[model samples]
Target: MLAHIGGRGFPPDEAAERAWATALWERTGGRPSGAPVARQIDAIRASGDRTAELRRITAPTLVVHGDRDLLVHPSGGRATAAAIPGARHVEIAGMGHHLAPGVLDRLVDLTTALARTHGARPATTPTPTPAPAPPTEEPA
Candidate 1:
């Protein structure tokens, strides 16, 4: 689960807002009316308790956050990671509000490694093993 943001997850500019808004409005079973959208936003803000909801989740989760995310705000990500029990949080610096534009391969390597491993532990020194002594029996 690669929860990436701060790059391509949001619209690149104001021009795409209409389409984005329309899709979101339609998905919520409401027509794309201005007042309805405003109401939806307000209702979302007034929602109730969710600890039971969060705890009901059964699958593994990944929480990725950008240190300088200006859109969704870093607090939301932090709270989200905290709310989900046992969720892993990863923070990257200088990754703005779009996650798909720059350094894709590097991002892939990072996210993949994150999802797969808990990161490299400091290497432990190998203990030296003593070699066994050979035949002194030939001298007898």
Candidate 2:
């Protein structure tokens, strides 16, 4: 579960994994308790479908998902983009549920571009030219 939820895209970082695992263990009662985790799972299950509420969101939205995410499946991101008007969905290849160290710069670039185009507050990261979309073939 930790492997799937944490960085599954890149090579394992034992130090980082240990740090997060320790922090999570401490948060969930130190001696190992699944109650908090169970409650979270229950809450998510109880939330029901929220398509109508998602449609009501008017802000410029970006839905970024990992193509390899096993924890939340890539389809969830697609559905979210479909529900929200004008929401742009981006699926990063080789990414899982967590952001691997290698993808950080690319994410920063993508987000910076989004913020700039939307006229949001200035971003500290210098925005690079956004990657061009892959060309699609039209049926003749």
Query: Among these predicted structures, which one has the highest lDDT?
Result: 2
lDDT (tens digit, per residue) of candidate 1 on 14-115: 445457767887897885557875887898688765656876665566677766676568776777777887876666665555654454555787667765
Tell me the lDDT of model 1 at 25: 79
**CA deviation > 4 Å runs, candidate 1:** 1-51, 114-140
What TM-score should be assigned to candidate 2? 0.75
- The residue-by-residue lDDT of candidate 2 on 32-84, one tens digit each, is 87778799999999999999999999988889898888889999999999999
User: TM-score per candidate, in order?
Assistant: 0.45, 0.75
Q: What's the lDDT for all of these models?
A: 0.63, 0.84
